[model samples]
Target chain A: MSVSITVGAYGVAFGAAAVANGFTVVQACLLSLLTFSGASQFAVVGVIGAGGSAISAIATASLLGVRNALYGVIMAPHLKVKGLKRVVAAQITIDESTGVALGQEPRGIDAMRKGFWYTGIGVFVFWNLFTLAGALGAQAMGDVRAFGLDSAVPAAFLGLIWPRLTGNFERALAVGCALFAIAMTPILPAGLPIIATAFIAIAVGLKR
Target chain B: MTVQIMTTLWIATLGTSLIAFLLKYSGHSVPERWLSHPKVQRINALIPIALLSALVAVQSFSEKSQLVIDQRVVGLSVAIVALLLKAPFPIVVLSAAISSAAVYNWL
Candidate 1:
């Protein structure tokens, strides 16, 4: 429950950031409901907020979303469902659900399935609800920048990536990617720099 | 002009949603061996780190086509400190915003 709520509550930042980026409250909610991936959802608003072309926005958001596909691969065996249930499982197969499910592996497959469902559904509910609350709150604030909500965008990004920097290699690669993107920012269009970072990862991955 | 921009945003929004769903579903449908290769897995794992770190840099320091260092840097620093101290997500984000806002207002 704590994990679900913690992850879900961050949707507030996404919601506020989306609105600050010019999306309507309904659009913010729709992104949460339909997209349901925090990082990708943030990428969408961030790219569009920066006046990026729609194709750039879509590309950036879709790239960030690739991990969910991998997660679905990991969880598919444990979640042997069909038809509508399979669709639901795919939709909720995210970092939290996969993490919680795998963490429950020591107990048994039953426990793992329960962990996945509870956490996935739990996060989905809380995330959407808080997204609404955040959108309404930011909409009422009139000027989100004055409140320094603009800072929340990068800070949220930092917070999301911080946990993943588990070792020296990951940390160094992250710094390199950040510097590269910053260097390219002045030369490239709004969303392309972030997209370009993928090549760095690809190059490093292939070299190893 | 407004309608055109809105149309673009809607297209991006729907396009992203469709892709996200397909990516997730495709994982379950595709053979595990296709994505389970070590090189593929390693690159896949690193992609989010690369994209997110770049996002942090671009969002914190850049504005449009220009690189501008402003209060957001202060905010990001505070956020880093808060994360190091193991602050919760909300605290990290709030403290960063508060510090940045204070700097913007007072300094």
Candidate 2:
């Protein structure tokens, strides 16, 4: 359950990345507090790191975040709480917390409530903690790519998606989309694949 | 810019929460017609696969992706190998991370 918070800890790393990329410490810290999704944060920072415009980077990260669309759908019933609380529930519903919440049974509500709250608070705390840590020692972190920690993001995604592989069709689709994205990575914008993934998922769903 | 940033943050929050809530809530109704068929289950399951593949491509592969490969390729390969060897997923991830670093430094 706390694994969800691990996603948050990546916040500190992201803060460091953001500062290294030229955002003020306040900007880095606030991004984590406000934005919570590590992949999108990384994607945003990666774009800036690569010298892309800030607006473009923000758009890319936000686009990449579209997967949360499906996560939202997957989580709605589990959390079961509604109205304004629905709004708060939505904030912490990232891949980790959603997975923990959705993986359970009718206890999903209990799980969602606890998991979401716990993970959300945990991430919030850790994200800021690490962000501050990272910000304080930005230079030492070096090239995140060189440390290979950047790879954890996709590895995490694989962990998030691995359970969905149930057949040849699914296997083929996952491999195909991954390969396709990889091939066009040089040309496609950062967030495009996220949209492609959702569409592809829908297409595969309909095909089935 | 603060207003814009805050607004972007709000929109992103509300927009994503609503979407995720929908995805989570949709599970409430498994759709009896679909549940009745194995074919449909097989198909329904594929959507996640497609989504995952799209993610791997976005995160791992690129237009700059080379047929010759590089650290990420090596890292992913190492992780896949670890997974096949039954390393826990986190371990697999860590191994991949380390290998990518090794590959990066190697070059």
C-alpha lDDT (0 to 100) for residue B57 of candidate 2: 48
User: In DockQ, how does model 1 score against the reference complex?
Assistant: 0.79
- lDDT tens digits by residue: candidate 1, A1-208: 6775677659889889888888889989988988899999988888887668889888888887888988988999998988999999988988999999999999999999999999989899989999998888889988776788879888888888899899999999999999998999899878888889989998999998
Off by over 4 Å in 1: none
Assign candidate 2 its CAPRI class: acceptable
lDDT of each residue in B9-102, candidate 1, tens digit only: 8988789888999999988889999878889889987888998898888888888889999998999999999999999999999999999888
Error of 1 at A33 (Å): 0.7
lDDT of 1 at A199: 90
Give per-residue CA lDDT, model 2, range A135-164, as digits (tens).
665646667677776565456456555656
Candidate 2: residue A10 lDDT (0-100): 55
DockQ of each: 0.79, 0.29
